[model samples]
Target: MKHPYTKLLANIIAYAASIILYALNAGGSINGLTILSITLATIASINLVRAITTITERKQQ
Candidate 1:
């Protein structure tokens, strides 16, 4: 989405889901599912940051 808030929300949700996965696998072994969530969360966070930066730059114009 172009809106920064939407990106931020998505990022938050992704992070929350990722954390949940980690919490679920908080024993000893790590699996692909947990790693996937974390990867998704990282991607979402990057997207969020990019959106926020662009949004601010647009506003500054």
Candidate 2:
């Protein structure tokens, strides 16, 4: 029920990279990359939230 540190770290890096890419793309008027980065960040955020919730629920049980 414990959180996986490695997974968390990976997610953190992914999330950070996504944000940076998104911003860079947006600022530079790169439509395709901006959209892709946004999508990736959204997915990563959802997965991270889900993982945290699952770990919390398992601990409570």
Scored by lDDT, the top model is 2
Each candidate's TM vs. the true structure? Answer: 0.58, 0.54
Please list the C-alpha lDDT of all candidates, in the order they appear: 0.72, 0.73
lDDT of 2 at 42: 73
| Residue pair clashes in candidate 2 | none
Instruction: Give the Cα-based TM-score of candidate 1 against the true structure.
Output: 0.58
So what's the TM-score on candidate 2?
0.54
- Flag regions of model 2 displaced more than 4 Å: 1-30
lDDT string, candidate 2, 1-51, tens digits: 555565866767787777776687659755676778777877777787778
Residue pairs of candidate 1 with colliding backbone atoms: none
Best by TM-score: 1
The C-alpha stretches of model 1 lying farther than 4 A from their native spots are 1-25
